[model samples]
Target: MAVLAIDIGGTKCAVALTDASGDILTSEVAPTPSGGDAETLWRALWSLIETTVGAEPVDGVGVGCGGPMTWPDGVVAPLNMPGWRDGFPVVARLRERFPGVPVRIHNDAIALAAAEHWKGAGQGVDDMIGMVVSTGVGGGLILGGRLINGGTGNAGHIGHIVVDPAGPPCGCGGNGCLEAVARGPALAAWAVEQGWVPGTPAAGPVNPELSEREAAALYRENARATGRQLATDAAAGDQIAVAAMNRAGWALGLAIASATHLCDVDLVTIGGGLSQSGPLLFEPLEETLRTHARMGFSSRVRVVPAALGQEAGLIGAAALIVGGDRYWSP
Candidate 1:
């Protein structure tokens, strides 16, 4: 069966057409209309969907969107997407557009977990956690060979797990949350505050002669100091950048240790822009995890980078329909 998959995030929105095995047949991506109102953003996304799907009939539609949403209902108010902070009825609109086909929506992080378990890093593992440490930190859990949707459908939300009692304030109106310290922008900001200068940007506007892809790359490079730049600097041996990575890694390990103890999960698959930092991040994370996760069961847990890379979100979204009740319920 053909399924329509949508992945919505602050930086970009992607749509894909996939078969039963979650292999994408066709896909499209565009920068998110983050500065626009909800209606404008939705219209843009719908246009992308229409263009990608064309006249092909999909059997079901599934969406993975950033969270703090009312799930099953799919009323989203993703913290990073300011335009949708008031909440958008994504599932209702998808149902309206697709009619008889089943429509499913879940936290993007949860979708990532489902994707990993279905076809990626956690494929053979019955209990694991999938985490994204990019624009923000988020996670989803699988246990006993099935996805776990807690009371509010927000169960494996590890981003808000506190790693330090006296750390920075978080966007969730709490202090010392893991997201507050480890999210890309937050980590970069922390690095800047500690006197680390990010990569220098070209002085002029993106050259009109450049290809669309090149121009987009230039624009992003010029926009702000982000976790990507921090990683670059760390690789170049910048002390403050190294320190920032260590801090983020340490925080991630602490939170993971807590999650291991709580859920008894044995594997963690991490993805997203920041995870690209390679060993600079994972080494400290491993060291810290070993320090705190000393219990017999938790000690065996392993953390690894996600195997599906950028397509994981879309694949996971498709799994909501393709995998049937194994990854989706209500």
Candidate 2:
């Protein structure tokens, strides 16, 4: 029997039909509704779900979502997707849509951790952390071969960990959180503050043409453009871009090292759009890890890129139903 897998994010919603072995039979994606309300977002997700599995029937459904959520109950108030701040009754809706099929919900990062443990970087590892660093930073942990979902299902939320007490403010209302320093927007804003101008495709080898006013407008309007474009610049040897990425990597490495000090996880698998920046990010990350990890065991922990890539969350959702035996341990 196939499992219907759903992944909801701030920018998009994805649905997939997968069998027990993690093969995706069908999949679909849609931009998140621009209205940013619960009903509008649900409409987009419902459309993707129907398009992906309308004719095909599935035995069960599993959902992965970014969260301030209640698992099993499947209610969510994802910080990135404020439309559901009042809390979304996701499991109830899925149950109503697919009557009699088992339905379960997981924090997206936790789901990714489970998927990684089953088939990706954490395979065969008894203790691990899975992290996604893109528009935001998020994480999940597996220790003693059991997925740790804390009292409110928010365990392993490493993003909000305070790293710099005097650093910038975070959306979570904290100061100097890992998310505040290392997320894409933070990196871009830092680069911009240091006078990095975004190069345009049309500008060729010439410096960016935009006046300061025009550049600031672009920066304000397109928050992610800075980080994405800066990655390109860093690859081509732009000093400021490299510095921005280096700072981000250092902050992330510090956070991971701190977490390792506490959990002593054997591995940390990073998956996210930012991870694609490759050595421009990872080099500094490794340096920081080596510099900050004081304990012998913490220094031994391996940090690697996630193998399943973009499909980790979808596969993880499906895994909740198809491979629970492989992941769950008392």
Best candidate (score: lDDT): 1
Model 1 error, position 241 (Å): 0.9
* Model 1 ranges off by over 4 Å: 200-224
lDDT of 2 by residue, 283-322 (tens): 9999999999978799898889988877888988988888
Q: How do the residues 141-229 of candidate 1 rate in per-residue lDDT, one tens digit apiece?
A: 99988899999898887999999999999988998999999999999999999987675322223467887667656656664678888
**What are the Cα lDDT values of the candidates?**
0.90, 0.84
The TM-score obtained by model 1 is 0.91
Q: In candidate 2, which residue pairs clash?
A: none
232, model 2: CA deviation in Å? 1.3
How many residue pairs clash in each candidate at the backbone level?
A: 0, 0
21: Cα error in model 2, Å: 1.6
- Where does the lowest 10-residue lDDT sum fall in candidate 1? 197-206
**Residue 251 of model 2, lDDT score:** 90
